[model samples]
Target chain A: MHLLAIDWIFLLEKLILIVIIISISLGVAMYSTWWERKVAAWIQDRIGPNRAGPLGLLQPLADGLKLFMKEEIFPASSNKILFLLGPCLAMLTAMMTSAVVPWASHLHIAGRDVPLQIADVNIGILYVFGVVSMGVYGVMIGGWASNNKFSLMAAVRGASQIISYELAMGLALIALVLHTGSLSLGVIVEQQAHQGYWNIVLQPLGFLIFFVCALAECNRTPFDLSEAESELNFGYHQEYSSMKLGFYLFAEYVNMFISSVIMATLYFGGYHIPFIHIADPNFAALAGFIFLFAKTAAFITVFMWIRWTVPRFRYDQLMNLGWKGLIPLALINLLITAVVILLHTQH
Target chain B: MNVTQILFWLLSALTVFSALVVITRKNPVYSVLWLIITFISISGHYILLNAQFLAVVNVIVYAGAIMVLFLFVIMLMNLNADAEPQKNKWLQFAGVIAGGCLALVIIAALKNVDAKARIAETGSDIGLIENLGKVLFTQYVLPFEISSVLFLSAMVGAVVIGKKN
Candidate 1:
């Protein structure tokens, strides 16, 4: 009964924080689409999308408006309900991971200290993994509901690809968990921040495995066989149009943004501003938030850069890399970590 | 009612409703989706018991991975209502009778239990990852290792079955 006591201020704070985080995620996702195009253009030696506003800043807005205005199409053969459920689920799973991510250390407001995260759940990393796994259903159901052969095929490929990469991703995470000895993202980040040495320095191989898995998990290029335009003819979202299609596309960008944030938080000393020390608590919180955003932005840029630079892998090659290459490598890394910890403890 | 009691009743109701839907759905795909809802409601019950690790793992393993595989197989087989053959009337009658008898037997077996004495306070931290990990590695280490070996054998069996002729 004591645990069930309701605190109105705490509830209100969480509600407001949730709203802010959701809006921030949506805003970052919107800009990521613009940034992706800009990066692609720059890499190819072309000025990209400079028409909507200064340096094509308003292009995502234009794209959003166009998608909203487009005709909504539901094929005659398609399952009406599940087709709609697809993008909604996609958007949901994309946003859900943000709940556990510690955006900054802590902000003191009105004589009260507030944690910047929505929920510091005990099993934060597992929650993220669960939500990410659920993300496959959105693509799977949407493609199947379309009632098209190619769409179904694409859905199957997407589901299998996600499952395959997830094993390696979990293995990579286990290695890091062994080093940190915690499942809570906040605890992991705080440990790194206190020590001033990120997990990346100690777990370089684990980070590389994790980075590859993140690319596959987000369905970025070199791993985006599900939506290969040349082969599958627009793939899973082919039958979707208007806002439905926009949601699926938007969800992809949001997933990218979240994964980039996850990468920064898990390995790159999240919100840990290095080489500069601040004594003031309030100032440190703001600086930490900015530093985390900068790291996430850098990761997002790398995601886009690789998307443009690397060619799409053949399906077999993708499977081989995930199952044979990354999984075994991650296992070896975990074994090495365990042995090192054992030796150090004995000494 | 207390918050915990209210949440327990709500989640139980959802689980029952979804389980009913799972059994009654005409489409296998819809049935799978309803089963996922059932799993999610059960996970909510686990969370209510403060087993956060089990709650998340239940969703990841059952609703996420297993259900996705079920959906993939259903799609691959193109299983539709039209493809399902109707059972004979006598067989259907026997199924209902058998199910009712099983339910009666279970109820009879549990009728003697003291339910009120078994009720305990919730929000225990024993279900947290750290506590559970310690218990599993220290006290249940042999069983854990045995289960992993079982999984390895199952995997090898699957590979053998899946090999091309």
Candidate 2:
């Protein structure tokens, strides 16, 4: 309402959230690489990056430093303007989407209660999806600008794959919206405050479709035709290296983290725990924040687990699942949900 | 003006600017990008409306999915500015005249509107979906039911167009 504004207090709060989310995303993206290596090693019965630091935990740090120290090379024939813009855009958009996610319930700082989110806009989910969608441009622009056939091809695949999967993903989310009857993610989580029951219980099909689309959207393997190393030799990022390449790589993890958090918020009842109720306005907000992060971490583990387990899909098969399978199923799910809601209201 | 009102004006200006860019940009790719900026700005407007549901749906459907498809098409076409046919002179003339008339009409309409209309202050707590549902099913039941049919027809239309060889 008229109460909403970019006032100093609100601006300060938003800035803090941005700073926190960006730092966490960067840190997680780095650690996730090590985590992926360790997880892969454990699965394959081999030692991971154990030499960098105890269990190679500092490996990401070492890798990051190497990227910074490496020479900055611009391809001779590339569109230099767009080339520079691509990775920056990629990293920026990935970091930007996390702004709306309800990270905590609420915080009571300086005797004033504030929501632990940057902006509790009515369309939190849509905003997340919008920002996430913008990410493809970074890949597409980067790939095209590289002027490398390999990069262009990879970008094409990335674009196509994202387009196909997103339909299914959006449809799946529609069913959830129908169930939760709200688009504000903060409100959605609040409805599930009693931890015992979550949207996953009622919308399992939606969850499955959502998770699959998330994997594809994040460009993880099995759906990562865009970056099939065996075929494309690093895909859209073929011409990228050093920090530019690091941006592309890190952005993927940041997206994975954000998507995982979104999934947790949607299905697992973000930051909601039962019996330990904090009805006090200030305390409830704080509790909500903790619940959100915990839920997000759990979903992140699931993302890692699936990445390790699944084999990359054939490009055609991936399209088929997205367009032919999931989309239609999601539509059917929405129909069924509508009918159920109608019947429930009647009763 | 208070911070929220100042912020709202900034966001609204950005939205309008991006929307204009969406239409005016010469590069197809840049046009798509501008449209995305428009989408994000509109989402900002939704947040302002406290209709968070509509805002998210707007992003998910328009910015997230549809815009991606538009980008994919533009990329597939691999269009360059020079590759595009130059605008016809008469068409440009007509467009300018029409645009001028449209701008004049908008300004005239705005002039007649009450400048100090009471700004409806809806709280953030009333979630969009529940309120939308109540309004949709009760006050707007007929229109809501009709819209479902319209959506169904649109779905059919999409399938028909997409399926054509």
TM-score of each: 0.98, 0.84
Q: Please, what are the lDDT tens digits per residue for candidate 2 over residues A1-347?
A: 22444367777777887887788888878888888887888888889898887878889999999999888889998879889889999999888877777777767778877777777766677777777777788999899889888898899899888877877888899889887766788889888874468899999998999988998999987688999988888899888878999899899999888888888889988777766767686777766666767777777776777778888888788878888898899899989988999899999
Q: Could you give the interface RMSD of each candidate, to one decimal? A: 1.6, 3.4
Cα RMSD for predicted model 2: 4.1
User: Which TM-score values does chain B get in all models?
Assistant: 0.93, 0.85
Superposed on all Cα atoms, the candidates' RMSDs to the truth, in angstroms, are 1.6, 4.1
Give candidate 1 misplaced runs (Cα > 4 Å).
Answer: A1-4
What DockQ does each prediction reach against the true complex? 0.77, 0.44
In terms of docking quality, how is candidate 2 classified? Answer: acceptable
lDDT of 1 by residue, A1-347 (tens): 13467677888899999999999999999999999999999999999999998888999999999999999999999999999999999999999999999998888788989999999997999999999999999999999999999999898998999999999999999989988888899999999988889999999999999999999999899899999989999989989999999999999999999999999999999988878888877888999999999999999999999999999999999999998899999999999999999898898
Best by TM-score: 1
lDDT of each residue in B95-151, candidate 1, tens digit only: 999999999999999999999998654757888889999999999999999999999
